[model samples]
Target: MQACQVEQLLADYGTEIYRYCRRLAGFGPDGEDLYQQTFLRLLEADLEPDEGRSPRALLYSVATGLWRNESRKRSRRAAIARPVELDGDDPPPLAGGEEPEAEALKAAENRALAAAVERLPDKYRAAVLLAYGAELPLEEVARIEKLPKGTVKSRLHKARLLLKKEMEARGYGREEL
Candidate 1:
């Protein structure tokens, strides 16, 4: 692809791709690095846009692969490094016009949900993040995951059940999730 085409792709899909990376990497510096590296890989590959493939899907596929590879490396390093506990920051205060209490409650629920998702096994986490968090259709998710559509659906179903149970255990009603 030409430089102009890459610029267009970044304009069109960059935010969604970055958001997906953040969620996939649990929202940290690692996510920011992954987001940068996704576009870099795209540029390096110099791929012509295929009529059958959406650029958004291609960006996501790249991000997912990069994250998986980095995760594997991190795991190997983790085996030798001393683990450190890190505290998560509290959610920002609600802006004007909304009820503060209600906003705070919603934030708490969201944090709980995110925590539950982070706790999920990697396979289930990837399926859930791609399908719901990134708002990708099952077919596209399957294509990116290189899994059968039925297998992706099954994984999504199982992920939803696990998330529901986790939220319930955290004192959230099913409706809230």
Candidate 2:
């Protein structure tokens, strides 16, 4: 694709890619960096975004690869550590009129989900995120994760089981996983 095409692609899909990155990175500045990195990697690799198909899946596949490489680097740096507490008091609340309880519940759920996902093996985590978080169909998720369809199903099952266990431990008893 030409430079104009790439720019047009960005204009169309940038928000979706950024949203995916934000979710993947647990919604922090790190996520923004990762979003930019995904686009940069695409530029570096010169992979044209195919508009006929799902750009969400394409961006995610590239982002997942980029994230995996970064994870490997962090592991090599001996950076494994327990999850940290994310206190709500640290950041000011949003101006949008959201009920406190609803906001708290949502924030808690997101944090718990993030921690649970972080615990999953990378392959399973990637499958779960692409399938559930990104709302991609199984076939596309399988392709992105580079696994057979059956393998993707199994991984998703395992990920759900693990997430259920994590939620139970976090005291969300019988409330749905």
Candidate 3:
């Protein structure tokens, strides 16, 4: 792809891709690094845009693959290096007309949900992040995951059940989620 075309793709999908990275890798420096690496890979691939494909899906696939590879490396490193845990800070409250208490509650719920997601198994987590975090259609998610559409749907259904159970354990009612 030409530089101009890559620039346009970044301008269009960058935010969505970054958001997906953040959700997949957690809201930390690792997420930031993954976001940059995703774009870098895209630049390196120099792929011609395909008429049948969505650029956004391609970005998500790249980001997912990168994250999975990095995660494996991290796992191996953890066996040698001293393990360190990094906790992401809560996002700032939304600026709106809503009451402060309501905003605080919403933020708490979001944090709980994020924590729950972090605890999910890799397969389920990927399905959740790609399908919902990136807002991709089920068909696209299946294509990216290289699974049948029904399998993707099944994974999503199972993921939702796990998340619901987790959220309830965190004191969030189903209605709140």
Candidate 4:
């Protein structure tokens, strides 16, 4: 891809890749680093984005590989003391008409949601992140995970049930998810 096309790809898929990496990394800065590495690998490898297929899935495949490799290296180096906290930092401001209180509430909900996702088992977590978080089709998720469609569906279904229970335990309603 050309320089301009790479920029266009970043503009389009950057946020989704960031979110996917954030959920996988369980923190922001780590996710930010992985996001950069994902794009860097793409650029260095010079793999063209196949528009006929799912760009989101392709981006996530790259992100997941980079995250897993980095995670293994980190685990070998040391254990994590605790899950990172998101309370002090606020999400970026919304456009007009959204109150500060509402934005804060939304951020809190997002944090709770992230925590729940972080608690999931690795398999179900990957399924949920690819299928829902990255908004990829179940077929694409299965392809990415190297699982059958039925297995992906089962994993996503179970992940959703667990997420709903976790959210409710966190004082959120079932419908909220």
Q: Judging by lDDT against the true structure, name the best candidate.
A: 1
Candidate 2 lDDT (Cα, 0 to 1):
0.76
All candidates' lDDT scores? 0.84, 0.76, 0.82, 0.77
lDDT of 4 by residue, 1-177 (tens): 466766887999877778788888867689788888888887788877576777666777888878778867876666655555477343333334644687776777787777788878878888888877777888888877878999999998999999898777765564533
TM-score of 1: 0.84
Clashing pairs in 4: none
Sorting all predicted structures by lDDT, with the top scorer first, yields: 1, 3, 4, 2
Against the hidden reference, what TM-scores do the models get?
Answer: 0.84, 0.75, 0.82, 0.70
Instruction: Give the deviation of candidate 4 from the true structure as CA RMSD.
Output: 6.6
Encode model 2's per-residue lDDT on 1-177: one tens digit a residue.
Answer: 456755776798888778777767657787799999988877778886566767667778899888888878867766566546566533232334544588786786676677778668877877877887778999898878777999999999988998898776665545533
* lDDT digits (tens) for residues 1-177 of candidate 3: 677877898999988888888888878998899999988887788866568999887888888889989989988999899697786643443434654687778777788788788888878899999887877899889877878999989988998999899777665674532
How much is the lDDT of residue 89 in candidate 4? Answer: 43
- Cα error of candidate 2 at position 129, Å: 1.5
The better-scoring model by TM-score among 1 and 4 is 1
RMSD of each: 4.7, 6.0, 5.0, 6.6
Question: Which ten contiguous residues of candidate 1 have the minimum total lDDT?
Answer: 90-99
Top candidate on TM-score is 1
Candidate 4: regions farther than 4 A off: 78-110, 171-177
Per-residue C-alpha lDDT of model 1 across residues 1-177, encoded as one tens digit per residue: 677887898899888888888888878898899999988887888866569888888888888899899989988999999579786643343343654587777877798788788888888999999999888999999998989999999999999999899777666674532
